[model samples]
Every structure is written in structure tokens, then in C-alpha cells.
Target: MKKILIQQLFITTLMLGLSHNALAEDKKPATDSTPRQSTMIILDGSNSMWGQLQGINKIVTARESLKTLLENAHGNINFGLLTYGNKKKSCNDFTLVSKPEDYDKKKMLRNIRKMNPRGRSPIADALKQAAKNLPAENAHILLVSDGEESCGGDPCAVAKELRQSNPGLQIDVIGFRDEKEAQLECIAENGNGAFVVADNTERLKTLLDGVQAKARTIVNVTGTPVDGNLPGSIEVSIKSTHTGGTPSRANFSIYRPDGSNIASFTSRIQVKEYLEPGEYRVKAQWKGQSYTNKVIVQSGKTSTLRFDASQSGMLRLSSLNSNKEAVKANYSVYLANGDFISRHVHQDNVDLRIPADEYRIKADFDGTIQEKNISIEPNVDNNHVFRFE
Candidate 1:
């Protein structure tokens, strides 16, 4: 009887020990083997950053907020920095302040402290340059800007190009004290990222916290345009040029004369709005190219706008002096209905697209003015040389 009791006790003890070992194994934390993500901060150093926001200079506020954000960033993620408008007066001003690597808070903070805002805001150029600094795939970009692209480049087009080329690239935009929300939002949507507004330091910190969390996750991120309905009853028809055919996919933004967006559409063929009768700007993006034209709308008539992407021909203008040498000149283009289309100055050679039509051309070189009528045929390239003899 004593042997039997001892054996039973031993069995119970062994079972308990096995159960505890199983439980311990179950509670062990799983290891994460995902690759560390990278992020590039595209900072705007335009002169407008000097403007006051809540009675503090925006540049100063941005630097402080960025410093705080960087200090609190995750240790595993790599970070880089790029800035524009600080190097020169040209729109191509962009500088890579830091190459992406493991987080170094002190180094990033020092670079932020040295940024001085000057010149025009070249948001598009900055974005392109920042994209180059990131990995070819699955890289993240955070653009902090106080204004829109003051340079000639189209940020929306550039964003679209980056996204198409690198489907894994994400580009979030932070618009600080920015009034051009539509433009920034477009960039974010096209770049497969989010757009957030930060009016102060606290808000910026909160936003950066979210971004940091996003950077650490292993999930894929995507973006889409904001949902909204057209406001007006005016009918607008958008058609591709005769040669290019109709664009299967495109984005449109219609602005009032005062530059306020009245309507926007994504991947749409026609737009119907109740816009007031006046002149407006119609901007369209298709297949990485941007087109803009001034449109006149009548109260009850449907306005038709055509984009001459394929059917349009190139019109090149050049000037020569009495000695038969190339000289800079000014030129103006007018439509068949006598409406001025565009003007160029100080150009020795100007090349532009014009829809198939009969129109008047004018050129001025050293006070000599020449006017002539010419016809542009569809799918043709035409060159005109003006002699100032």
C-alpha cells in the first residue's frame, strides 16, 4: 500500500510539470522577421515658410515640431531628409540632407535646425528628387509643405508617375498652414498615400505618431480620392483629341476665376455642374501629361472642351535677324475665333501643341512685328521661321 501511494504521487507531479511546460511554450512571444521600412522626409524650404502661423514663424515651428517627431521615432526604421528652395533662386533647387539609414535622432535634428527658407516652392521637383533617394520598391515618403508648387512642374503628374513606376512607393503629404488643400490632396491620392493638415505643433506630433506607427507595420498602404459630388448643373463634355482618341482614364479639376475648385472628377468622361456663367480654368491629367485651358461657360449651354493629345500637331516658331542669325523674339497665338491662346517672350525657338485649326500668328523681333495666317492640320508638325530683314 505504501508503494502504490508513492507511485500515484509521482505520476501526478510529472503530469503537472508537463502541463506547465506546454503553457510556457504557448506564452512565448513570436519573433518578427519583416524587413525594416524606410522613410524620406521632403521638407519645404520656400520663402513662404517665413510667414507667421499663430504668431510664430512657420519655419521655426516646423523645425521644432520635426525635431520632436524625429526624437520619438522608432529605432528600427531608417530615415532620410530632402529639402527644396534653400539652395538657389531656381525652381530646380533640391538638396538631400541625409541618406536613409537606421534612425539617428541627433543627426536629423541638427539637419533640421540648419534649414533656411528661401526662393520658390518647387514641390514637384522636390518630390521627384526624394523619390530617387528612396528604395526602388516599398519605400515611404512624407512631404511637409506650407504652400503649393510655385515652379512650373505639375506635382499631380509627378506623383502619378512615381506611383506608376513604383507601385509600392507611398507618399503622404502634410500641408502646414496651406490654403491650397486641393492640390496637395491630389498629390497624396495619386501617390498612394494620405493627406493630413497640421495647423500647430501638437497636431503635427499626433500626425507624425500615426505615420511612425505606419512605418513600423508590415501591411500595405493605399490611397484614393476624396468622395464628393459635383455641385452645379452646368454640363461639360471632355473629349480626347481626334488622333489620341478618348482617354479611358483621367482626372479633372475645374476652378473658378478666383481659383477656387468648383468641381473635380476621377476617371470620368463628362462633368455636369451648376457653375455660374463666367470664365474658368479646366485642368486635366491623362497618362502623366497635364493640360489646361480657359473655358467660357454660359448659363444654359453645354460647354465642350477637347484635349488634343493625339490629333494635335506641334507648332514651332523661330526668329532670324537681317544677318540670318537666330535671335530671341516674342510670339502670340490666336484661335480661329480671334481668341488669344498663349504668348511667349525671349524665345529663339518655341514649340507647343495646337489643335487642328486655322489661326493667326504674330511675332515681334527688335520692334519689327510680323503677322500671318496659318492652318494646322491634324497629326502634322509645322515649323514657322520669321525673318526680320
Candidate 2:
């Protein structure tokens, strides 16, 4: 009996030990979050977005979506609003309905209600302007667009350029009954964001409001840490080589990880800055150019973070007659989102860092032949090649 009792006790102990071990194996560890990111909402007031559906105009549905987005947003998340309906020519046309601040249900809803659809879909211009509303902190842009550019501008190209300029910007695009829905997908993928489509206004409202809530929450920034450390400050070395024409004189800023101004390097081909620890945003001129990389500073450790910028991508235009490659082809590239990457072109390759997703590439060879709907993938450095005739 004593032996049996002892054996039973041993069995129980073993089982408990195994259970603990299994629990340890199955348990997932928690990660550290770096505070929060900022979000900007650009609601499309284009006429197409105003189409009627289910006894309501799409613009009305968009308003409801804005309300939902507002209601769902976290109390701390900041958001700004810009409307484009009545005016499309001037950056002043799209008025700042609101700057990124706390959630204001009444204000947001009212702004939506006040939006009158009357202007063209100047998406690229709107996006470029919207960038001003957002701080250089970890930020995202949720742009809702319907139809392609009635104004005949490339929103997808704008998104691609912005993304290449800053790999950190998250651009989420929503298409409401867009015949050109495919293009917006390029914008989202390249911008490190998602592209969603809504068949109706309710869905659009639900998605936007819900997504806005997520955007309003706290955001932590992440990136490659510098290998080494310097006690006081770190040196940032940048080399920008423009493949084509001479780069225009430009000025931009970089914010440290702590959201502090670490260094202000003049916009030039080569420059350097002394920075402290934290994430930083290096803003270049509006000429639509920039790239990202890192260098580390440690008390006792010396490390270097290497970043290379070249216009490369997974999407290529093939079947180029040897003649096409022989001479410079003036071309512009467009991503899926209603954005324009290149309005003007060169005969050879233009280095645009596209997103890591499937895309539709459009090429205007010699400004006469328009080749549209070319599929592309991200991680484009060497995975793809272009041959255009």
C-alpha cells in the first residue's frame, strides 16, 4: 500500500511537470509596442463617389462611413480631414476640414454632411497636399476614391512616389465602385497598406469607420537599429544619386524616433547629420524623391546600417523591340492606386521602389503607345526585368 501511494504521488508530480512544460512551449510571448501612429483621412468628394445607390448617394454613404470611422476611433488617436469636391485646381481648394486631433463625433459627422460633391478627382494633388496635414511621426493615409481620375491625374503614381520617398508611410486605399479599382491596389501595396473595395455604402462606412478606429490608436515605430552606439550623437551619412536629370534644389526634415528633430540636412546629393537615438523621418523636397537607411550608435559598440536606393521593381514591360531599348524611351509608370509614379519618362529604367504585392503597370512608350495593365510583384530589386519594344 505504501509503495502504491508513493507511485501515485510520483505520477501526479510527473504529470504536473509535463503540463507546466507544455504550457511554457505553447505560450506566446508578448511584444513591446512603441506608443502609436498617426492617421489622416482623405474623403473623396468626386462626382463619381456621389453616385446614387440604395436610395442614397455614394457621397451620403461616405458621410456615414466617416461617422463610423469617427465613432470607432480611439480617444487618443489623431486624425485630420480634407475634402475635394468643389475645387480641384488649387491646393487651397481642398480645405482642411480638421487637423489630426482627438475624436470629435459631432465635428467629423458635420464635416461629412457639409461635403458637397462638385470637383474633379485630383487624387495626386490631394495626396501631396494631405502629406502636410500629417506629422512626420508614424502616420497612415486612408484615401477613399471612386472611379479613376476624371481630372486625368495619376493618384497611383503619387502613392508610389510617396512610398519610395518614405518607405514608412502606410497608405490605405478604398475603392467604391471603381472601374479603375485595380490601380488603387498598387497604391496600397506600395505604400505598406491595404486596398479594400466596397460594393455598397454600408460596407464602405463599416470598413472606413472600423479602419479609422484602428488608425486612431497608439502606434509604435519599428525599424533596423543601428549596430553600434555613440554616447552623445550618431552620424547619418546619405548619398542620393539621381539617375536622370539633375535633381532640383530641395529642402526637407528628419524627425528622430522620439519624435524629436535630430538633424536637419540640407536637401542635396550627399549630406550628413548628427542624431541621437530614436526613429527618424528624412523628408526631402516635393520633387518626389527620397530613400531610407540607418546607422547605429552605441556606447562601446560600433555598427553601420547600410541602405541602397535604386529605381528597381518586380514589374517590367517586356517585348521591347531592341530599338526601344536602344534609344531612351520617355515613359511614366503607374501603380494600381489612382496614383502616378512617373508622368515623364526616360528610354531606360527609372528606379522606383514599388511595394511588395501584385500590381498593374502602365507604360506610355514614346508618349504615344499606352501599355496598360502589366502585373508586378514587390521585393523588386532583382526579381524582375523590363523589355519594352
Q: What would the per-residue lDDT of candidate 2 be over residues 1-389, giving only the tens digit for each residue?
A: 99999999999999999999889876633233544556678888766666865656877766766666667554435667877765554434677777775435577777778787766777778888777777776667888777666556777788878877776677877666546776666566456554556554433443454343333332312332222222212223333344334333344455654545533434333222323333445444323443333345332222333223333244443335446444445555554553344444564545555434334455445454545555443344532333454
lDDT of 1 by residue, 253-325 (tens): 7787776775576765444333444688877655543456787754323356766556566788899999999
What's model 2's overall lDDT? Answer: 0.55
Badly placed stretches (over 4 Å) of model 2 are 1-34, 87-92, 200-389
- Highest TM-score: which candidate? 1
Q: After superposition, how far is residue 197 of candidate 1 from its true place, in Å?
A: 1.9
Name the runs in model 1 displaced over 4 angstroms.
1-34, 200-203, 219-389
Please give the lDDT score at residue 184 for candidate 1.
77
Total clashes, candidate 2?
A: 47
Going through the candidates in the order shown, the clash numbers are 7, 47
Candidate 2: lDDT of 167? Answer: 69
Number of the predicted model whose lDDT against the real structure is largest: 1
